[model samples]
Target: MPMRTRDSSGRRLATLAVCCAIVVLVLAAVAMPVAGHAYLSDSDPANGDRLEALPETVTLEFSGDGVQVADVTVTGPDGEDVSGDAVIDPDDDRLVSVSLERDDTDADGIYTVDWEILAEDGHTTAGSFFFSVGDEPVDRESVLEAYADDEDDVSIATTAAKGALLLAVVALVGVPVTAAVAVYPVVGRFGVAPSVVDRRLTRVLAGAGVVLFGAVLALGVARSASIGSSGLSLEAIRTFAATPLGHVWLVQLLVAALVATGLLAGVRGSLDRRYWLGSSLAGAVVVQATVSWTSHSATLVDRLQGVTVDFAHVAGAGLWLGGLCVLAAVLPTVLADAEAGDRDRLAADAIRRYSIVALTGVTLALLTGLILAVWHAPTLAHLAETTYGTALSAKVLLVVAALGLGGFTRFVLLRRLDPDRERSALERRVRGRGSSGRGSDGRVRENGGREAGDDPTVDETASTTSTLVTRVLSLEVALLVLVVVLSGLLTSTPTAVVAEQTDAGDPVTLEREYDDGIVELTVGSPSVWGEHGSAFVDEGEPVVFDVTFTSASDGDPLESDRPVTILAHNERADTQLQFDLEATEEPGTYSTVQTLPDPLWWELRVSGSPEGTYVSEWVDVYAVPDGHEHVHEYAPLEETGFTHLLRIGAIVVGITGSLAVAVETVRFGRRQR
Candidate 1:
């Protein structure tokens, strides 16, 4: 093929690849599983309630799976602990309760219920609320004044430890897999005895294993410190090892130790070299899988599917990023030692083989990354508004940059080392194209054999291509490392939905009588925007107004013939919105779903008709707290039948792509052997 034609063809191919990648990402965003740690959903003797009498127990409910009560304490007005140990409900894992202790003089002032919960996904969340036992309404500010709510401090050291652990995991998994799939096979095929290279690789693998082992240990210590303890103590480690997170930590420690031992055994020649290498590679994959289980994926209803996709995502990353580091570290030495006559041939063959592995890695990383992004962030609004979404966006951009660099290396730089084109260069020389006897790649050839430094132009061109490849590779590796660090942060960060839920404090209630001694209305304020209260509802999510009507004369429940409606007016924004209430199974009680438009104070009235038929006095309420501005007008697209199918299809594609790479690796290893 003509030089111009080949160049144009390569460009076209690169463009097509990028377009296909974009389409795949679009498809993967169709619908993702809502996977986040548990958040408080509802509570009995609810927050900010003024009770006629104290209930026997205070129960808390959550919206996530595998919830375990870490701590629950109820303090009386005198600041005395009045609750027994918190126990998970026998029927529902999401529910936990504590029995309250009452005296003859049951405190009439405010009582605070503080709680902490641990989800199986390795995260802890805690919150507090206040309720009173007398007729007087307690100001929220008073509750804050009387009892200082302790905020959980996020340890920076813990975050750093997590990042280090992730880096080590990627390196450990990548080194052996790259050696087996790319380096070993290609060099063997080139008739290059890789004994020296093998020794160096074994040392590298051993070092990675050591790092992995140490990282696992450091992560445990950091985890202990985050839980409010000096992690240096054995008791602290033992305490951490007793929780659900501790169980996973134990598995990680075991895997890291076993993999390190296997690699070391192979290095010392005490074990079957091939057997240990293969075992260690598989162990590395297990470590990667364990890491996924500790992420938000662990909270998914389809936990197995979520973890499988997550594992594939990181494994693919390890293959690509680790392989690049391996190539950059080892390939230079191999090339420098090659015979001058065979250097070009060996370089071409080895790089070409490694290119296939790299392509597979990129493909898996891109596809699975799309699945993971949607799973974690759901909507574009979430991506723009939430911390987790922002980090994910940054990672996606870095991946794209890495992809571009890889494509440039494969199509532009690697093409210069094509061995088959040596004959074509000689043919061109005979045809008098140029006396230089050079190929289109600017490499000199003597009767189908490369001759080093024969032409200054050829030498300079080769030098330039080599320099470009090295620069691109270095940048790509750096970007990928940053991507991994972000991934670690994401694994620890709460999803946007969870963050909103956590921010939403307890519900506030207001009651009023307004019908000339005929009827009464009580409203439990609903907020779609999360503030520092309970019952957090998200924008576009259903905001439930829990209300009841009672006959003032007899103190009996009153049922209205017509459904009740609430009209809310925000004086600040001059916005008026109305919603009709639906009757629940409870008599005289009605609930309605509405979404607040902004976080502003609003006056609400309950009525049965539109024209001044107000049954209750206008009551003041904050639909959403001040300063929490609206970020989006619409909610994320919920899963439809079609989107569900699309999600399933994406998962299948990810799994299939990963399996194809695994098969290729096995084939390469066998052939090289």
Candidate 2:
């Protein structure tokens, strides 16, 4: 093959390899969630069953085999967790019982329990039910739905507040922090001097620091409003300080204060050099910690591992993005300041240092991003199906675009602007600017100054490279900002479905005897039709319910004169979902496939006229919360220290990598010049 063709082949192979790697990551990530059929066979108080009082233990009986219960949260009349530690039946796992903690609530009004289960066969399912006390009629589905409503899921103010906080972090911390810790040091080694860097860099960092501190406060206030029962109120704000979210808020406030103090001390140029650097980096690491702890990682995946990977992701992004901002904002001014012999060397060092930051950033972002995606989205279909998955997909695409742009600049544009070419560009720029070249102190030199005798072409080359860097870095910053914004959305956006589609289990069997031992209902093993099944219904997806009614005396199928239909009532809205059933070839069996409209407890009312009297009987059905938003409502089970090690390792690796790049780039610049 020709040289050009061989190069083309190499590029093709590289691209193919990257594409293949992504496919593998996506495939491997499908975190097969624990799954199995776990439907309600019986409840202690019985759904919609009026009771004079409630039992101490809320017992849930499931007919399915090997059912393990989780997320068994109970809300009483006052909307507090009444369900305490839930335990599965020791002998028969099908019976899950939760002890009630009713210090604040008696057997009054309505009590709702939202529970999920994992089966021995590897299928996970979830549902909710409502129980009434003291003769108050519980509109089964309505009361349960209303009891579990999430105000934050649809709140625009919440989304906007989170987005603002994210943008503020990137601007105030990402850019300025990276500049102070990563960018300025490299330029200073070309004799830019610590004093000069402090003078020029402190103003930006100070302004950004103040903005970040303010943003942290604003984020806290917004969080209180979003998580409160009422939207944007003083009481909500006050109560927020007591929640787990409030705990995160307090941590963030401390980190913000530390960052502000470090920026102030660094800009003063009065602190010990090591102390200044150590304090600033420490503050930055804490910022990443606060972010990781409050982020989706803390709730969505394995807590410690998620936090560690996310910390690396945030740290890398902060440095890389921060460096880009510094370049874009400071480079144009730096290029116009002086036409010196070492100007090209200075530009080269800065570019190489930033390249290293970008390399680390891209690597961290891609690696952590894959883990998060796979944890939340176990399959490709989830990318489109879940809101969180979709937002993350968008972020990944944007990051990739930015990475490609950076690659082009580093490998193509930066390579083209070698020492000779960059010097010529800088020399020409000095002539075109129309001002007498300035001295290193930024004061204008006379027309006959020392720089006036130098080759104009040398100045033009470096100046051209600076301008190119500015333009490319500007675009890169824009993309990075968008990724940050999408990240905010991903954190706030609710998952569309709570149940994981990991294990498609065998059919579920249900039998209910109603109507004075006259009518018997049998829901046979559910079979999946389309995207939904009787075992677990996906929203707006159809499920084929294989239902049959038989006479209690003979244990035979019952024939109805009036048309038989299934009514899935929306309890909140006082509406009903009707699915007309047709008689099957088998005597008493009837089948119908209908779409489940929304995620809520549906009153499954089967009505018909069998022989003489009109017959109507109902059972409660819950298809899980559409999104797994409830997982973070309370603190998760405490994790082991093993997870914390992951985060510590990432923090160490990031700082070490940054220091290595700064040292290497400074040395290389000195050598090359």
Candidate 3:
């Protein structure tokens, strides 16, 4: 009884470990995905808040990992970067702080901060926020508009290059390893061992691998060089050679060299199976580890776990899918000339042997894939709703379908093969269908369409099942290739967890560029932004009309403090409103307590020249009637509530798992006693 109890406990523990590892990884992945995307979390002055005056230091707090401090510019009302000597704190790089050296803080207008940051997840997030000193409340809608994507769209050529590089890396590592582990072993067992043809193929693939890696290396160096420079060139390699990413890229070059060496050894007939496996394994490790450092894994709060899972996932995918490439291409050729009996035996043996390795690889790849998916998307609905999620879902379906075919080949179809028999039933069936025992009758049919694996020549019989299996296998391989393509595309897509909500009402913002920076225009309604129009203010029944300007180029305020004038025209009612807006205490804001005579489509146009260039903006404000006096609620500028739910889920799962372990242990102890 005592021995039995220990064995039971051991089995249970093993089960628990596997289950817990997968569950815990997934929960931890989801736990902090909200912060995985580096975003501006907090600011010293706070967005839309009015400050008494500018402070000596301007600080921005970011939530997430891999926040690269590209630039932190604080534009005062004068449309210039007031943020002096931007620096990241050594202790906490997420905290970007800059000094405000000038007295421009006294100006009454919206003070803007423009930020450009690179998240380690290979994405760039650029945005601007406004805090007022003497001006009206910063119109967030206008600010968002001004800060919209005025920059060029993400480079299409760059994305294609990245995709090619990713494919090359996967094949570079996967092909040699798969060959050593699966292809060579199976083909060698069938007496079609590695030969000069194989060697030549390896040589070509190795050369292609080296060339591909070189392209990737060049791109990496080019990216490093182009970070703050004007363009990409050979000159950038000198600068790139010094950066951490550059160092990692160099390490990848070493790994690529190993891959080439391994392939070359096989090509030269000097390759031991162990040597090829070991070299490919080492190369895979370096490539996986190095890529993970700058990619999605770097953004995870649990860096170690994330990186480990990433390595496993990437390596597993390369092996499983890449191996299929070798199998699909080389399998037919190997079995083409074998006797009917030998062909059936050989095909079944090869597939069944490879199945075990494939199953393991597929399982790890899928589990890790699920873990990544859960991290990037808060819910199943999010996956269905988001493009990234949709792509992932398609990839998952493809994997499942391919795996199903693989299982069929390994189990039902292969198990039925009896190599000892004189002729396999599959070949027999094809022969039975014909007048004579052969693949072709040497006669044209009325339909002019060939039967399954049937030919016009009578000399040889065709096995329909073999052809069917081959076709199925080829389709499965094709789907897996698509899966890799989708994975590459995903590197550029935004996860559902980071997508912003659009329920909040705001105007389409616009931007005007200046020498130092760009200014943003956020449009707001009278109810949310206007002053109390009950007193001395004239024009219609005075509502508060405010114009908030924030600059992304520099944290300077509007250079001119002259009385701001804006003309409001209602084309429908044939009415116009003009306000000579006085400069509020805010540095770059012009405002007056005013309203339109009757609520209609009112166009408010303001023109100003802030240091760099002339700029004009027209904003439309719609005031609806229903016994007015309505105040709008500003959208929360922090993370969505969904992130907090994931946190709650993690806590719940952890507690449950712990309790389960405790309960199991206690039960076992009591039984022993």
Count of clashing residue pairs in every prediction: 5, 32, 38
The whole-model lDDT of each prediction reads: 0.64, 0.56, 0.57
Per-residue lDDT of candidate 1, residues 26-75 (tens digit): 54454455647765655787555667888889998766656643568899
Error of 1 at 403 (Å): 0.4
Ranking by lDDT: 1, 3, 2
Off by over 4 Å in 3: 1-35, 101-109, 135-158, 200-208, 218-222, 225-243, 261-277, 336-341, 411-468, 501-673
The most accurate candidate by TM-score is 1
Q: Which stretch of 10 consecutive residues in model 2 shows the poorest summed lDDT? A: 524-533
Better of 1 and 2 by lDDT: 1
Candidate 3 TM-score to native? 0.63
Candidate 2 regions with alpha-carbon error over 4 angstroms: 1-53, 56-129, 132-154, 164-196, 226-235, 261-278, 340-342, 421-461, 495-673
Window of ten residues with lowest summed lDDT in model 1? 626-635
